[model samples]
Target: MQHHRGRTRIVGALSVVVATLAATLVPTVAANAITGADFDPGHIISDLQFYDNAAMSEAEIQSFLEARVAPTGCVTSNCLAAFKMDTFTRAADRNICTEYTGGSQESAARIIYKVQRACGISARVLLVTLQKEQSLLTATAPTSWQMTASMGYGCPDTAPCDAQFYGFYNQVYKAAWQFKRYSTPDPWGTYQPGNRYIQYNPNPDCGGSWVNIRNNATAALYNYTPYQPNAASLANLYGSGGSCGAHGNRNFWTYYHGWFGDPEYGGLPGVTVTRFDVANRYESSTRISQEAFPSAPVPVVYLATGHNYPDALTAGAAAARQGGPLLLIDGASIRPVVDAELKRLRPQRIVVVGGPESVPESVVQALSAYSPSVTRVGGADRYEVSRSLALTMNPQGPVNEVFVATGSNYPDALGAGMAAGYRKVPIVLVPGTDTALDAATADFIRRLAPQKITIVGGPVSVSPGVEAQLKTFAATTRVNGANRYEVSTNLARNLYATQRPTTVYLATGLTYPDALAGSVLAARKSAALLVSHPYCIHPSTLSAITDFKVNSVTLLGGPVSLAANVKYMVRCW
Candidate 1:
């Protein structure tokens, strides 16, 4: 039941004293691009948006409330930030929410967590609803009535507040239950995820418009509110609206966008993809490394800074040649998680790539505890580092094969890293923008005197002059395509020319960290490392999947880096 304007609508839709407080909820840097005009009445949010209970922990929820309701300005101890209540247990309901195991003297955050976990609704949604429905989020001195109708669960425009759902805990629980109920089988019969004519207001004359609801969660939102905002409401979302306007649904969109991110899942559902991820890039590297080398003590481990990308791929290549894992770090100190991984790997020797600036002496000294022999291989910059690393990889002359790629960017060079490792050769780096090969790389190429030279990437990545310079030294050729994804497929296609590879590593082309580290794992497994769009695998990558007869694909990063949607469509192509 919504209280619009003078009716029991979304009261805060009109500007009040809490405007300053409302602004703080939307972070400036995280400012959502969606505007009021972009509001979709049918698809209010996604199933993932509504059901991701892990979106916020109890501590995070408490912090959010504390940030919203500043204690010094608060006149009432009854604010959500300071409020606490004894909570009870709830039984599991498949159609609605799971059983909530409540406890005595529960804080607002705790109660919210229980309800969120049990009902499988995001606590973020619960927080936004509190702010939208009653401004309870920033309420300095709310009346007993405000908390009573906290979520406006049983408060309809035509009737007074229901006494049974009076308290904050009760309101939160019942509201979560009701929303979950709407998502169940045979949901509110009138509203499913399709076209539906929802009214603008309680007034019969207000009429309705057709909205194609996206999912069950969206359907649940419509069934709960039962009214759509008129054009006037969308025109001025932050404030009040026209005569026939309803702000319940409008405020829902604005609050959600401002507080959380865009709740819309414009993409498809998640495909079953094995995401080798933890908290961040460093952990993701370790997770991927662990997957490649389940147990350790076999040989050596390559250490590189997760912050610096230039040396990571070469390090991965070198590590693969030695049959080891490439681990990423902060360069300054060893993370407890990294330390744990090192202790598990129990490498005979740890090789630190890059100069002191990249992996300083302190980190090297600290790393000595994990391995008996620790060595450092680096030079002035990434180009020198790559040269020195390549030389270190093969100290002897007559280096059988050589691969060259741009140091300026990562994607084109990503597939080359695995190819170099597969042949146990060095992958050298040169500045891509340069017209010709630099003296150091030329001298290194002369020293190696390779039988075959394969320049990975298009002319943009490796210049024609550089290719010509390489041809002077040996039989130089190129494996390239229009884009990073195509280049990746071309390199993989060249590697497994005679046989189909069994494994493939899929990493996001939008970023380089995961691909940089995953390259080694792919090489170790004799698999292809394909660059992909965050949301979907490229056409070339899909074709490569089929051509190579890849039975497994390990997605390198988390959902944000490479969306699960891409994983679902991998089999399609």
Candidate 2:
């Protein structure tokens, strides 16, 4: 069955609309950048954004039309602003659509609202479609052809406009009806919400790509237009893209964003965000560990001090290599809850990281009650502990690689931990103040003889002198940013963006417990861990979703770790 897209371009049509807009209307303020790559062929616009009936009231629609043209500008009497028609009532189509009321001597705005109320299609969509099809909204001299083919309802490319559908009320009703009609179970359109090959131009010779259409709104737009803009058209959004360009859907997105706002931004929209949290950070670890090891026996469980986060960074990497969970415990003695969890996990051995000073000898002895074998990997300081764990975790010589970060802070190393945990390697902590890489840290890495070493922060955190020293050990790559936020995004891009993982773990960048625990969970889930401000999500963090093509985010902790408002920001911003 053949159906019509909204309309093909008529020369000087959109230019008139653009000029009218620049002269009278306020310029469009878009929240996100309009780039070709960010264009989700699958999700051009969300269903909620498309079917919103109350998107505009009668007054707002009238105001929009009035602003575009003036009384003196009109060469004819029957302009869109002054157009009036008698609208008939529409019956409900069961689950397909709702009913619309009829009216006599109704204004164009009133007709649009009634039709929208009946069909559940947005008035904004109707308004934009008017201009996109015939420049009806801004034309000073409204031609008979423009008014008759107002919404471009039944005007197929190879045939003349059907006389029966040639009226203001007729076109608006038919267009809105067609949009809702395309959503039915036995929809009468070629395109639909799935993998589809959409053409760049009507001429099949121009070629196209397989687009994963996400919803009815996007599919409806394609069914109406039947073509996507080529790279040349996308490259020149405001103007022309030579002969291959198609402007129907492109103008629809542009007009909506410019006049109203982000088509998908009225509510918390785009992607799904799931939360994984509990009373405290300790539970977050145990829960994730249980998820990773559901219905299976654990070989080992690693313990690190809850008070300090540095040791856990390296310990996490080692624990991951051994298919174990890194549990946080009090420095003086293990918590009763942790002890209880230990009994439940029932590991063959318990490996306690850091020296007795960090985890007292009494605690080590107490751990033995749960597991017959209790091993202690102690070092004089955090740096030493990081090195010790790297070697102990990998009995095999020349492991894949290791991550090196400053011991002074946890942010850089936190990112390093995720990569290491995922790769089942190690993360070594180096003293940032040391002008040269310490012999101890350097020598421990030399023994591992990794193929590569990634420095997690800039010179301030891990100085250039140290980076040079590590190069001697293996091929060296550095992941850094102006602040911790940039480092996290860069690491996420480097690690997981290639495969385009939709799901990722988000933790507050201000602290370490949630991210520390979440890193292992991310590794277990085969995802990346990202950090941001506790309340307002960072710009970089939000933009990363579009750049990386991530459609799902899992926040690791409760409001205590990341505030409730952060959830809203992740989607809207």
Candidate 1 deviant stretches above 4 angstroms: 1-49, 52-270, 273-277, 391-401, 409-415, 418-425, 446-451, 458-460, 474-512, 524-573
Q: Quote the lDDT for 544 in model 1.
A: 81
* TM-score on alpha carbons, each prediction: 0.62, 0.54
Clashing pairs in 2: 5-224, 42-214
Candidate 2 residue lDDT tens string, 365-415: 888898989999987888888888887778777888888889999999888
lDDT of each: 0.76, 0.76
Q: Which candidate is the best by TM-score?
A: 1
Candidate 1 per-residue lDDT, tens place, 1-573, comes to: 332111235333344422443465564123346666788776787776676654566776888788776645567768888888888877887677888887888998999977987887878788877876778877767789778778888776667767777788989998888777777775653578888888887776978888888788877777667788887767766655566766766677777767655667432333223556445788888888887899767598899888867877677778888888888888698888888889998999999998888888999998888988999998888899888888768888778889999999878777788788877899999997788988988898899989999999988888898898889999989998988888888888999899877677888887777887887778777778788877556778878876766666667876567653454442213
Q: Which ten contiguous residues of candidate 2 have the minimum total lDDT?
A: 21-30
Residue 335 lDDT, candidate 1, scale 0-100: 84
